[model samples]
Target chain A: MALDKSLVSGSMTMLILKLISERDMYGYEMIDTLRQRSNHSFELKAGTLYPILHGLEEKGMVRSYDKEFAGKTRKYYSITSSGMAQLEERTKEWKEYSDAVRGVLALEVSVL
Target chain B: MMEEYIRILLEQIRCKKSHKYIESEIRSHIEDQIEENMSRGMDPETAERMAVNSMGDPVMTGTELDMIHRPQMNIKLIVMIAAISIIGVLIHSLMLHDSFLQPETEMISGHYLRDVIIGLCVMTGICFVDYSVIARFSKLIGGAIIALKILLIVKSLIEVNSAVKWIGYGGIWMSWLLFDMIYIPIFGAIVYKNSRQGRKGLIKSFMWMYIPVFLELLSANMTCALIMLISMTAQMYLAIRKGWFGESYKAAITALVSGDVATPSIAASVVKAFGSVFPTNTFNLYRDIVAGFIANDERNYITGMLRTINKAALLFGDSSSELSNSMPAADNQYMLTYINCHYGIMVGIAVCLLIGWSLFYMFRSLIKQNNQLGLIVGTGCLMIFILNLALNILINLGAFPIMECWIPFISAGGSCIVLSYALTGILLSIYRYKNVYPSDVDVKMPKLKLLLEQ
Candidate 1:
């Protein structure tokens, strides 16, 4: 099932940090990777992606710079150490919450 | 197509500091998106459209960007201006009660207080107005002021025996002095429009200034007229040196004096230009007025008055009461003399401090402005305050001819107070939008650059 935007939006910074931690990427690359990694289930619009990137940059959680890549100048964002730490904490919290939801769902299904 | 979209998006964004980086980033993002779509076998046009559409909405994105980048008010500048204005008004009220100058014709303090309130509201209103809007409609504004000034001059002419003063309906004296200052933004606009064309543009700007100078000369207010001429030239010099002529002022002057630059027929061309714009009868009248002003020997009258005022001031040591008793009524033209004599040297020093502080704040703000028009307008306002302060001081010290001029905010004229406040408001607006251009702008100030290095 597709995730609601409200659920996805709250984790935008975490998702962006997670993507950047793997490799330095620009806005379009990050959006594409997030969709492919989620099997086309999670799609962050350009409008949504850029603001989150900018917010992360502003908060010092990520840093961005312009560099030539593939014969074209692109602004690539990279995760900082702080961004990595936050990503780790967020990943752990997300795993516990999803596990709790799945346990409740399993109980309901067995009862049926 | 992507570039065009980005252009429109940026046009909606107000903050100039972030504009360049944002532009590059947006362009890079759009290209990457389009390329990704192209890899999926989409046509170039379709891929471009899809990339742009996926950006959500340009307006929404621009609004989001604008929130992060807005102009900031200089609080210190505002506080400094407020302090000076309050001090000016208090000193004005003190002048009214001193009772040494003359028996009061009307309660001027009440009128001044009312104008102060009105002026404050007007100032606030102008502060919110974008100065670009003022620049856009400058021609209409210039024309309207010219018409108003001409009408006032004519009205003053018809009311003989009260020949010098332009008295309004209730015998309240109208200040044609400050009215001329409204031309400053127009001067900035004209220079901005024509700064790059050639010597021809410079002459055209000078001709526009000459219109007011000629009119004020006819109205017999020579000091204000002279001040306008000097200030306009200063503004033009600043704009031109900033590279309007594509050369330095020294280079341009050298070219002119060496006969390398062709001289335009200033008088004939100006007259011809005026003829084309105005009807025949009005043109003839303007021609006669110009001819009469040109023919009159202003030097003799000015020197005569200067000698008389200087001799009297030197002998008496206090010209307000002593000079007025012996000679013709000194009137408010001798503001510095009146202040120094009636109030003591300390009060005079305080008044000077107030004026000096206000100018200092404005000068600092002027230096920080990034927009070209903001720089020009701020410079023009600085010239006005500087010239007024300097001239008032010289006239007070009997160092120069006594002429009718006001002490900026402290002067007890309604129109002067209101218009001076309004001018300050415009300066504040310039200060507010001062950084509406990128900090990386290469403004040419060769002399200043040299001084700073030393």
Candidate 2:
């Protein structure tokens, strides 16, 4: 997973866009789910994850809400239209990349 | 299907997380694990324990998980502190002008400048003195102030009112000037230590706090008592707001049991009330006080004050008047409302409030995000202002009534204001040079001790 740096990073970006496409997620929860899905393979430390989320929010990839619940407040984030469009583009790119790798692996044994 | 498993998952989170987000995330993840285990037929309680075990230890996890709270320092605050202390000292000096040889206007103005100089010195002294050392050995500093107050009370009885609030010899509290000096260190210590902010620490500071004021009040000075009370209130308010009084508010407050209040009543209560100073010696100077209390003969108390006033008038060469020696025989704080003589009291009180509020606001700003420095000095300034209010109200007007209480950089002349400024300067100087100002960093306390010891 560490060696497949592009896959890991792209997967995180995809997961965040998917989660926020439905509802805004806090940085903490977003990291938590990403880790659980990958079975602790992606240990997204808060120090790293928060900055990415902030950067995404700044770049119009996400909208944020400072809201309260159960007597405590949290800042939540959701995907913007630009984020959804980027996710569509990335998904297409990911499928193409994987198909190309698979095609290379499944080359027919013409000699056999 | 896994209701019991859900219950077990909730138990996994026992407050290990400091950050709210991490706590909930971990808790819900545990819930998910519990449900997964229960689908395979694990019991709810065992599933809960297993889930908690899997997440990691609560203590270590929580610390690593939570975000830290950091407050920033801003500009408005610094200017306020510098302005307040500087201006407060200048204004206070005007009242201390000694009209001996120079023209009255020049003397007054010159004395005010002297206050400014002394005030600067005080700022430098306090600013430079390592507060941690003062904090580390606050016990010694608190004890010293308490002792001085006791000594002054004994001396006041012997000298009767030579303004022994500051000085004393033998057992009499006549040197009001010296008696007032101890407050500089007493209230200073409050700002010094209470700013450290622990229940035990503040209590320790309070013990040093009331001793001198209590003794001063006992010497029959009403103004000092009021001042003492205000200082504590302001200190407590700020300390509590800053979360320095521990986690709970209950411990911050203690019983207000005054030892003297429990003692038997006497005519001197009135004398103490009006004459506004408690005698240094707890023992009666005149043998007839007990008999006098029984007979309700407080006439001598008024007469005693009159004789003292008459003496000051003679010394100052004021024209004689019978009413000059005695008040309207009222038993109240506004003892001077009828006299209307000291027109200066009105101006003094008004100017005092304006200046007092300004100083308090400024110091409050200076120490705004800074609980340590703010708490100590804020409380000190507050206590002094409390003293100011009582004096402003009780002081008899018409002519210049000799002030028996000290007002830091104001009211009294010579060493009074100058010494105050020097101490203030030292405190500010210590604060200026010391790295990690509020912390009890071991490096600075030793230097503070050396400076203070000097």
Query: Best lDDT goes to which candidate?
Result: 1
Candidate 2 steric clashes? 73
Separate DockQ for every predicted complex: 0.17, 0.03
Q: Write the per-residue lDDT of candidate 1 for residues A11-110, one digit (tens) a residue.
A: 8777888889989998888888998999988877787776677656544577665557889877778787777988999999989999999999999999
Off by over 4 Å in 1: A1-112, B1-68, B99-101, B104-110, B148-173, B196-200, B247-331, B436-454
Report the poorest 10 consecutive residues by lDDT, candidate 1 chain A. Answer: A58-67
Top model number, DockQ: 1
Native contact fraction of candidate 2? 0.00
Native contacts recovered by model 1: 0.39
Query: What local lDDT score does residue B74 receive in model 2, on the 0 to 100 scale?
Result: 29
What does the interface RMSD come to for each candidate?
5.5, 11.5
Docking class of 1: incorrect
Over the stretch B86-165, how does candidate 1's per-residue lDDT look in tens digits? 87667667656554535441355546777778788888888878676677666667778888777765554454344343
lDDT of 2 by residue, B1-454 (tens): 2333323433343432212333343445566667766888999988877655555444443332222211123234335445644654454343234222234434544556555665565555565454444555655665665676666555555665545445545773233443454354345445445544565666655556555555554554544454555555565555555565453654554322332232213334544444433334433432333333332355335434533443344212233444443543221222233112223334345445655664465454434222244345435644564565455443433122333444444443455455545544433433342222221222223566777989
